[model samples]
Target: MWLDKESQIDLLAYSPFAELITNITANERLNPLTIGLFGRWGAGKSTLLKLVEKNIEERDETKKKFVCISLNSWVFEGYDDAKSAIMESLLRTLMDNQPAFEELKDEIRSLIGRINFMKLGATAIKHGMPLVMSAINPATATLTMAQYFSKTKRKEILNDIKQVWNEKEIEEDRDTTVENIRLFRKEFSDLIDKSEIDNLIVMIDDLDRCTPERVIETLEAVKLFLSVPKTTFIIAVDNQVMKYSIENKYPKITEGSEDFSDSYIEKIIQLPISIPELSETDIKNYLLLLICELYLSKGVPSIKANQLDILLSKVKEDNIFVNGIKIDLEFVKSAFEQYDYTILDKGEIDEFEKMFDIIGKTSDVIASILKGNPRQAKRFLNSFLIRKSLAEIYYKTDRTFDYAILAKLMALEYIDMNRFKELYKWAIENQKNSKIKELETITNISRNDEELPEEYRKWSDEKLARWLKSDPIDLHEKDLLKYFYLTRESLDINVSVSDSLGKAELMVFNKILQSKRATEYSLLIEKLKENKDIKYTKILDALIEEFKKNSKLLKKMQPLYICYSEYRSEIKDVLKKMKITEINLQTATALCSMYQADKPGFSDVIKSWTDKGLAQDVLDVIIQEK
Candidate 1:
């Protein structure tokens, strides 16, 4: 069963093109009107046109009289060919709306026949005229015809055709080609008008894909052929491609000219529709729900509300300043699960973190691949998930939940293993800071490092580090690691480190302290706050004293403080409350006393007082006296 992944759905909802279609379709005027569906490639122009077509098809009988025809000009080569193709398409479309145009079908066919005959005659004359014309004038121009036409009785046929053309009225009409084409178009328009088809909606899709000449030709044909009342032509195209096509075809037409491609199309088309981008929240929620659905299908337990809350909390915590748009991962994940696929535990928690890290690190790379197109983003994520499943199968392990695996998956298109390893090394080396900022900076490092002078590189690194440590904070160690891995893999190193490790670490520590077991951490923080000089000091001294008093407690707490000095400020509030102040000094004193009991001095006295938790305050008073 094919599940609906986030990529499959309409992530960018409620497009404005729908309104333009409604207004055009609702109007009863018989005059021809044009609407241009404009945007960059993959901007959902084709999707919008298809949507409008579907909507119109679903309408009741009262609205059924409206004939909608969709065509693409790229199927033909050059302007003349595309124009003929369009004319043929119009004929077929008119026939399809048999209920409305049945009465005028014969007349329409006749007009088509006349145009076809004219084209055939023109081809034959061009090919067979040379020999017969040479008899009339020694230096007559040679004639050439397309291979599709038969070459028989060349001289006799040319003579007969010339004699027919030389007749009084035909000879008098010097503008035969132009006049015939115009007359044929008029007849076709008249037939449509008399048929009273209510409305004629011709939608041209993928005009951008057409050659420049063909695109202009198609546009011009629409302007000429559909110049009747109650007719509307909607074209789906990339504005840039259209502009380029026009400039290429008409080099003399300068940029910003009133006769620019879009402006010319706009003169015929009343509405120019532009699809809006999907908000980040919408995108996240959509993906989350899709993942949730996938998980459920894999027999994973339904994500509980609290679990979803936790997920959302993580998302919010990680993305604190995402345009003031607040969303929890659980909400996003659960919605995705229920609506599309579920995020089944295919791997361990660590593996999942790694995957998330990859995604976080290479967000810009992924964003670039998607071309800022939401549909592409959905496709990429869905594809990544599928690849992860395949990898799980191949490895014969449940590493799908392993964050590293996910990171690998997220970095599939962004970064290679070598680059990912470098990012990993960078993150590990800078573990003293919060994970978010580190990962973010690493992922978004400048790709143009070579372009940067040595001085600029140093300046940039310093500036980035300072910026990463700023407020309205963004830095998260895990986030930074993931972003670094993903972005580095994708080779997009232009991302800035928006927050610092200290801030993110503090936030996490604060949250942990705010939980049920708050006493120890809170007390440690308060003590540290009371002693200004105790900042960023190792907690070893305090831990050793506690060990002397109660070895069990010391053993229980040593691991927490082992690397505390490296991340002291980050976890200062938590450490201070735990009464773990002056750890470095206390450790130094304890070591000195152990080595020099016989050589007693202030260091010995200080060591003894600190072990008893009395030296810090006493020393403060003593230092003041000195």
Candidate 2:
């Protein structure tokens, strides 16, 4: 019931890698080619190599063997010496590919032994080797000399092997270091010839996953020691990441000269082939194929796995190879339309088609959100399916889930988690207040005034509002809420619920205004008063609307009057947003009554009003109240 690992199927048809393999196999008698299979991690570079390996193996048995060796740099990163470890892996894999070459095995073993352990900071001392007495300092040597035989015997022994270290010796030591590398390369070339393979394709995958040091070490070893005749090193790594690794390895070169590090990497990777991102068509086909696979696995009624195979074949047939080049998606849709999906109900088939269409339409958006990464797409879909399966298992009822709605929400969840939580909370609260447990009542209905509950203010997110109003699917709020509760990563959703009571009160006030009949303002005030923490200033925006529509309603709002007496700071904000012209007689009277009782400097603020009549009217209303 999940999208299996990458390379489960050649979703892109493996054409690119097949061509690459063909080219590699055909190119003979050339020096070792270091081809960089460049792509971001999880962009299917490893999968491409797997397909190439499969293609090579499936080639004509009579032809020379394409000795494919797959190396994961991440695996060798943990070793003491990444350089030595990589070389050993290469030589060992080459030997394993053709173990019959006993003579070549000895040469490889000897060459591998020449790998620089000291340079990699690994040595016998580090591996529990006992210290030799002769290597000890003069003081320790003197003590050892006494313990062994005598001081006289030690002087004779010291002169026999001890020689003065000099500059010439250091020069020779440097030469030996260079000579060992040349010797190793020579032996590597001979081993390749002895193996009797046409081309030794060393596919190094996950180089980007290793630490910078390991990456630099492995690449350095490949270029210096292992780049020999008849070898093809296909390195899968991101160019930027490798560049960073190179810079990290040689900071002086990176800081002193920019092109120096770049040139070094460019020289090592002779043929760089970047793996392209999955196109929109490619993602659509991938998702559809995966959906079909899940359906088949679950033995869902309409679509079978074999039918999907037929669909794939149909698409393949339509892809006419023009000059050995064909667009893969040119016929996918046509094949989908023509495929007879058995005796499944037309309605069901139409539903699936709609699901497919929705996914296809939103493919680009999803790709962008996931950075055109096929693995992330698969993970998101897998997560959705897992949640859906869990929901079915737990509920085990006749309740149905809409794939389209869930897909939309899943994309939102993948993009921004907090917004998704807010939307889910809103939907759940909306459905609960609507008193509708059935899907029919929840779907295709506008929010009525009575059904709208006091907002927790958590759902006031503009993005959430836009997404819900956009109506990507005619979703039942109850179904979405159920999915939300099921799919949430956390057990408790209320932890992040907004504590602000202003937005919640605003929602309640908006609902009251939207009421067809005049809402009983007293009832709304009672609801507001229940939460004594309500700040009048925070919800002044909501009050402005009520004042405009039905000014008398304010007189009946005891809770708001109490807030006016308690929370004075909110008064200026409410006053600033208010219009003197819109202040009806009753609302003016209510404000005047508050000014009389509170006497919170309402006179000075009102005296400066531009509209003399409106200001004088309010002043006169205050006198009546007094």
Candidate 3:
């Protein structure tokens, strides 16, 4: 039900940690500070950083001098030189920011020119000089660029470097690397000094998610080139990852006196903050709120009329035992109570009460199995929602599942998958009627049963016993096939529904189907570029489905192709494999709109259009441009 992304709201009470960070960074006395926000993966580091931005903005509402730039270093890994990439990304973000930046256009342009020259110097060193210097003419000096930027400026930089090469002193140009770095630093500090801004906060997030080479390169860039006055870098990473990346980068930097990597970190990170793991109570409350939010979006108007701001703090009400854990239903009521009318006269109460118990009872099992990870908890909830929807889709009726039984079964599966599979096999093989008679005995029998077989002794585990003893008991009497139907992945399940997609993919698919504006499509294309591993066919099929059904949505699909060129190869390959002859004009017109002179794979589509008896001179006009 919940997408595994950073929460825009302070659900985990991350604002205090953010407040501490903002308190430190807001002071110009602490300028040039590199504060390390250390945490485990998915421990809300990104969310906490977002809250830090909020805190800074709130604190600076009167003056408005803080410029916050959020950058993910993992995006640059294996794609470009990390050092210049970070600088370039910072410049691009600055140009995009609208406040006092509009006045510094001249300084910004000069900075970009300096970076462009340094980029060319690094390229010449890494790729042999002759590749550029030997063929050092205006045409050949159009050096390769690592980014798709202003082509005119790219050519200008090329000419500058080409001019440097034509001076006939290659050795002098080689020394420009060190000289250029010193000049870049001086110019950067000068620019910051001349700006109207007081604090320039750059949040370098997901640094630990990058490869070791990128990790070293990015850190080196920050430490070596860009540590200027009135600037602060909030670096988020796992402690061990930073240490390990250092070890990988400098295996023998010292002669063994306590590791130079530690000293390196101690020097760069002036303040270290570690975000601790979630407690079981936090995990239970998070799942409960997610359930309420998920169900609220689906016809529960009372729950929506009220807000879910209860997650901002720990519930302090007296707790009663729901199954085995403490659940505060009174607090749940406070969240839903508006004008003193109880929710749906008891149906909503039962749903909320039941889910509180469902999440409350099995939280210990999940906390032990998954270490109470917030990301894993959200994933499990998403899995439960998908299976519930699949049950409805497979039955082709409005009758939904008994959410309690399905949830309990999924808890068992999450805690002990092997046990669940063995239970399923036993129901089919031993009971002979899709009934697990042994489940009744195993779930009920004592641990001291001397007559019990050794193979089934694991069912006596404490967590397993508690899970089975929870509500929705006696699975031995029900048809196991119906319960296992939606859980089975090998079934002929329909993937066109949201049930089959990940939380993010489903959201993207729905957006693709419904968005009618080119502006919205532009934003969607940017999101798609950020998430590269998303299945192209999921989007392609969504577009094709809409175009076939309504034919008006084709207008929405064309702009996405014209603008986003990063995934064009994958889109073309999918189209080539598809049978688009049935929708000839719809397919051919879109393909022709996307035609590029350098990019191939459109000939077949052109021939298909001709096969459909379209005009020949239309193709000729396109070919003439090529």
Candidate 4:
């Protein structure tokens, strides 16, 4: 299996992002810079950061060489304080990079030892942190102190901190903590000068993946390093997640205050860079290259790997993101003469060449529905290849497979799962009908023919009709065939995780089910209309039980009046339990307004309510709706 991780070199084309980093790193400035690479998860932010690091290394010989340190804050997030994780990680990395600054390291370690890790929550909530002190953590500081000094010396240091706490001159331990942090920063700058490094570039990644507390703690820790000269910090994060983390961390911002999270992030991330989503062309190129790489690794001899690499380099350099490039067989043969492609028979060469040709034929169809996401495109290919392999193994035959229909069906399944479910249902229903002319059409010939729900109606004619005629090769075993094998844990293709309601949606529906306030009625009515596909009984049963438990809610059931048609009999049962005279007349008004013109017996229903002893106010509402 291919590893989905960042490498130090040889990633996809990121010329635009690399150029921006190159420009920023090469310029001279007096103060430190905090640059951010913002994009969604799997949008290639981490890979781009690695490429930028490669670029810096390659170009450093002509300019200043940077001491680059890579720090993933999430790795140590198991600890109590996120700030301490960053501080300890940064210190260890700096020490590893510049072993010559032993004396300065000792002083920094001593200052770190002064911090009380348990007291950080109060400090962070009150004033955040001071530059040098903010990076201090109790766990790491204690560990580092033990490493550098004796047990007796460590106790003395602890005693001094306790004495300072008792003095009360510093009202909060925060003041002393800030002083120790400041001293460490001064010593750190001296260490940098002594090491003769041009600058320190710290690459911080995976920060957005941390918890809300960790995210806020990491951001606060980073602020301490911003004032240090000749330092650059590159942070990778998703903006959406960071915004949510900020809100979660500080839930009670002042009512009229500005957006606190955005304001704080703006102040910290000086130069923010975003990675754009993949384009259609980019996805096609990525898919083609990935498949070719797999083929070269598996089928071809080791020597051909070099040939394929050369071809890939040229293709990327020429900016051919599509798969329709003309092949020069003569040029390829000449180039591979040293490797032995020249010695192969023409038949073998032709077979090898077909691998490249197949990509061009299928790229257009695959790219159209993959939505320009490289990861999803890769997943589709993995699924297709796996299913193809399984079929070959199970049948024990050398028969050729036609992947065209499977590819189209897979696209439908990935893009819109519910549509695919309906298509699959229709395909199975007509699996035995082989005659193309006799196949059922989506256009109903008569009103008596069963009509699909509106959700399935829109996709039936275009996506489903074509498949009914030319179905998958395994139509005889269509009932057992696994079309959605790649995405699902089981072989069941008729259902999927996407078909279920999400957590937020379930919460909204449950709130509507038990709500008692009259003002919530409008929103409840809208929610019912929006979620019409969900079983109406699922909602009605919940409301019916809630009303049975709390009779007062029966009066505020006016909003549910719009949805009575789905549960007419059950609603009548609920109404019988309560006197019609006690019912809210506004509900009758709403019902008449909605159905008086279209419904046949709607006027009689209104007159029946009055005959059953509805109030004068209720009669007036019925007259107006009439």
Q: Largest lDDT belongs to which candidate?
A: 3
Candidate 4 lDDT by residue in tens digits, 1-626: 24566644332566667778866876667237888888877667777788877777776643234666778877967877667667767776665454434446665565355334435444433333332222434433332443445666545454555553342343222344555456556766765676666677788899887888788777777775334777788889999988999878656457786676776688678899887776767776666666545544222565534445565566656555434443343434443436343433333545545543455445554566666565566677777667656655654453444444445566556555554554555655665665221123333321224554422344344334333333343333333234443335432653423235456545655677566665685576546646754643334445655665555665445455454543443344555555675557646554455444335534455556667877877666655644
Ranking by TM-score: 4, 3, 2, 1
lDDT for predicted candidate 4 compared with the true structure: 0.57
| Residue 84, candidate 4: alpha-carbon lDDT | 66
Error of 1 at 170 (Å): 5.3
Candidate that beats the other on lDDT, 2 or 3, i.e. the better one: 3
Alpha-carbon RMSD, candidate 4: 10.0
Clashes of 3: 0
For every model in order, what is the number of clashing pairs?
Answer: 89, 0, 0, 2
Alpha carbon lDDT of each predicted model: 0.49, 0.57, 0.64, 0.57
Per-candidate RMSD vs. true structure? 20.9, 15.4, 21.2, 10.0
Per-residue alpha-carbon lDDT of model 2 for 329-377, expressed as tens digits?
3344455545444523233555555645666544534644566577777
Clashing pairs in 4: 132-181, 133-181
Give the per-residue Cα lDDT of candidate 2 at 532: 62
Residue 425 CA displacement from its true place in model 1, Å = 9.6
List residue ranges in candidate 1 displaced over 4 A.
Answer: 1-9, 61-63, 77-80, 102-104, 117-174, 253-263, 277-371, 398-626
Model 1 agreement with the true structure over 1-626: per-residue lDDT tens digits:
12322122222443345655756676876246777777776566666777677667666354347777778766666434466678777887777655677777788777666545334345444654322122212233222221223445434344444453342233322323333345656777787778766777888887887778777767766765555677788888877777787767656555655554555455556766766554545454434333433333333246434334344344445543245343343334444434322334344444444444444443423343344454565566766666555555655553323434343335333423323443456556777765534345433454333232321232243333322233213333343443343334344343221221245344434443344443555355335434444322223333333344443342223233322333222222232333434344434332232223223323443455556575454345423321
- Best-matching candidate per TM-score: 4
Q: Which ten residues in a row have the lowest lDDT in candidate 1?
A: 129-138
